[model samples]
Target: MHHSLFLMGAPGGGGNSSVLLIYLGLMFVVFYFFMIRPQSQKAKKQKAFMSNLQKGDKVVTIAGIHGTIYKINDDNATMQLEVSPGSYLKIEKSALSMEWTMAQQKAAEPTK
Candidate 1:
């Protein structure tokens, strides 16, 4: 039957299965490199950014609120953001928007 398949211009079963396995393996590797790896790295970077936050550093929240860090409550993972002088809001640490805050910082930088 295998020889007959070759004569009929069809792939043999044994070779096809190995090729299918190779394709499936390549797909998983592609997904890991293109999808999984970058996502994990970004999460790590975000975590580090959140951990290093300090008082007086400006930040934007996921809800689009822009403010400066007034105080951090490490015990409860929350912070007080000063949107304006004497005006503060307490929000969760996870609510900070790393991307937006970085973009705002870049935009505020003085270019040579």
Candidate 2:
């Protein structure tokens, strides 16, 4: 007589399922903001930097070669990296490092 069966109409049974779904949704939102959103924004910035490559701008390649942009062959997606005066190495625009270039620029600025 002490034993009872939990039926489909149990008071708390349905409540937990909705709570679990809400918790999962909240976790996805958190990950989207913290991880996915920043990654996408960074990719956009990198793409813009790649597209805006110009002659006479200094850049460092991802492979650690630093040089001034001698010529941009947008027709072929490559650039001539002049590591020294009249000396050049042709490489892809994608090989440039945006973060390194920004750091070098920051270091070159005079502090008041």
* Clashes per candidate, residues 3 or more apart or on different chains: 0, 0
> TM-score of each candidate?
0.87, 0.84
lDDT of each model, Cα atoms only?
0.90, 0.85
In candidate 2, which residue ranges exceed 4 Å CA deviation? 1-12
Cα RMSD (Å) between model 2 and the true structure?
A: 5.4
**97 in model 1: Cα distance from truth in Å?**
0.5
Q: Would you list the clashing residue pairs of candidate 1? A: none
What tens-digit string does per-residue lDDT give for candidate 1 at 16-86? 66666777999999999999999999999999998899999989999999999999986759999999999
What candidate 1 gets wrong by more than 4 Å, as runs, is 1-11
Instruction: Please report how far candidate 1 places residue 72 from its true position, in Å.
Output: 0.5
- lDDT of the structure predicted as candidate 1: 0.90
State, as a TM-score between 0 and 1, how close model 1 is to the true structure.
0.87
lDDT of 2 by residue, 4-100 (tens): 3223234657855666677799999999999999999999999998878799988998988889999988575898889999899989888889999
In model 1, state the lDDT of residue 33.
100
Measured by TM-score, the strongest candidate is: 1
